[model samples]
Each structure stands twice: as C-alpha cells, then as structure tokens.
Target: MRKHAGEVGRYIVNGLVATAVHYSVLMANLELLDFQSAGVANFVAALFGIMVSYFGSRYFVFKNTVESIISQASKFGILYGLIAILHGFVLFVWADWYAFSYSTGFLIATVLQVSLSYLGNKFLVFKK
Candidate 1:
C-alpha cells in the first residue's frame, strides 16, 4: 500500500539519521577513545541517539508533540535502552563466535535494532 510505503520510507530516513548518531558515538568511543568495555560505550552512544530520535520523531517522523518532554524522552530511552542491550549482546556474541569484526556485526545489529525501534516508537510510545 502507498501509505505503508510512505511510513516505511519515513522509518528508514529517521532510522538512518539516528543510526548515524548512535554508531558514530559507539565507534568513536570504542575505537578512538579505546573504551575497555563495549557495554559502557554502548550506553554512552545510546544517550546520544536518544536525543536525535526524540527530536527527529517529534518534529519530522511522527510530527506529534509529546505531552511531557522528560516523560516522553525517558520512556523512549528506557524502552530503547532495553532493546539496545539485546542488540549489542547479540552482535557481541556473534562477533566472538564467528570471529568476525565487531564493527561488521555492530552494523548489522544496528539496522535490526533501528527497525524494531521504529515500530516501538510509532505504535507503543508516541501513539495518538
């Protein structure tokens, strides 16, 4: 359907922006700053992505004003944080098991997580 296609396109655009912010922070912290733990690096990256996602969805993607900025942001952060944990965990495990580069695994995981996040944000978190 055309409506679904539009939604998917918007989802992809929003996701690309958010993922860039998220993955950039993760890669920078882990590769440049040499963070010892990926979990910590992921946490830091997630915060950055959360801000991007909140504003992007608020104005561009969903075009809906949140009832409470703090509440909406916090709820979104907590929900996405949980999803990120699963995402990072899977990528880390697969990288270790298959002896693939963490960066590669991370990229794949990020795409998956972003799609899931779009669904969650659209249907659950910020619905009208």
Candidate 2:
C-alpha cells in the first residue's frame, strides 16, 4: 500500500474516465437501443468500459513493467468478467426489481467496482 500511492491516484483518474465511457454506453443502450433489460444493457456497457479500463490500466494506471501483457490481461479479464456479472445483478435487483432509478443503481454498482478493481489490480493483476 505504501508503494502504490501514485498508482492509486492514476487508477482513480483512469476509473473516472472509464466510468464516463460506461455511463455513456449504458445510457445509449437504455435510450437508443431500447433495451428492456437493464442487466443486459449494463453487461454491454461494462464490456466497453472494461475495454477502456484494460488499456488505461495496463499503460497508465498499473504501468506494470514486470508482467507480460497477456498474463495481466488474462487476469484482468477474469476479474472484470466476474465483476461485470455481479454488477449486472445489482442493477437488475436495484432498478428492475425494486423499481429504483437506473442511475442510482448504476452509481452503487460503480462504487463497488471501484473498490474491487483497485484491490484486484493492485494485488492480483498488475503486480505493482
């Protein structure tokens, strides 16, 4: 933790950018694609968001110098895949079942992802 201060800051900045991409695509899917399922829409949006995060995390946030890109990416994929599934579940339950605002549910899920991602990337994927 002591050595990862800069990476944490970079992760926050990169995460914000990734979240922007996520929300944009989520809104577009909900509004433009006319998707009836928030879960599905979120899954799609997460795919895009995770892609952006992968590049940013690899090149910018983690700045991993010792690991192979393939190795990091494989772990990243697994981590984010699990996170995305859980994220969709949260959105489905919060917004779809409970009749809450999609925005609010998305916010909640994003917060969860932020914490999970930081820890996972730090200890598991990037190995910084």
Candidate 3:
C-alpha cells in the first residue's frame, strides 16, 4: 500500500513537470510564433512533453523497472502516441465543434491524457 502511494505521488509530481513543459511549448507556439493551428501547436507541445515524460517516468515514477532503455522508450512512445491521437480528437471536438478556445480545449484534453497516461505507464510500459 505504501509503495503504491509513493509511486503515485512521484507520478503526479513528474506528470506536473511534463505538463508544464507541454503547456509552455504550446503557448509559445500560439503567442510567439502566432500559430493559429491548434493541432500543429498541440503536436509540437506533445512531442516535447513526451520526451520529458519518458525520462521522468522511467527514473522517477517507476524506478523498479528491469526493461532496457530502448524497450522502455519504445513502449512509452507507443503509449503517448495513442494518447496524442486522443488528445487531438478531444481538442478538435472541444475547440472546433463546440466553439471553445484552444486553451480550454487543451485543458480538457490534458485531463483525459493524464488519466490515461498514468495507467499506461504503471501497467503497460513499466510493468514488473
């Protein structure tokens, strides 16, 4: 019980760091580059976030793994790739179909993605 709690705590902290990177890149693309395409901005941000998340999840969140770095990264990439697709779908529906702002869509998508990511990382990617 205690071990699971510690893992969950670490996952939350590392997830926050990765999410910050994701949002920063997204906002930079939107505000600095004047990018109007939410899909493009989200993709770029997710790429950066995935990189950060891979390291953080591997070393900080699930440190008991025995998989090689390549194996772990491949699994992580697959998981995030699926999650990114889901994020894109949610963003499209919320921002385009429902007439929400990009930021709002991003926030909603982040919640969905984070929930899915925690499960994938714990059971699929880093399973003992």
Best by TM-score: 2
Cα lDDT listed for each candidate: 0.77, 0.92, 0.89
The residue-by-residue lDDT of candidate 2 on 22-110, one tens digit each, is: 99999999999999988899999999999999999999987875788788889999999999999999999998899899999999999
Off by over 4 Å in 3: none
Error of 1 at 59 (Å): 1.2
Q: Which ranges of candidate 1 are over 4 A from the true structure?
A: 1-4, 96-99
Candidate 3 matches the true fold with a TM-score of 0.93
lDDT of candidate 1 over 1-128, digit per residue (tens): 98768767876787788888988998998899998666567768877887887788777777667467777777788778887787767666756566577678777778778778888888877777
Model 2: lDDT equals 0.92
lDDT of 3 by residue, 4-83 (tens): 99999999899899999998998898899987777777888899999999999988999945889999999899999999
Cα deviation at 1, candidate 1, in Å, is 5.7
Q: How high a TM-score does candidate 1 get?
A: 0.82
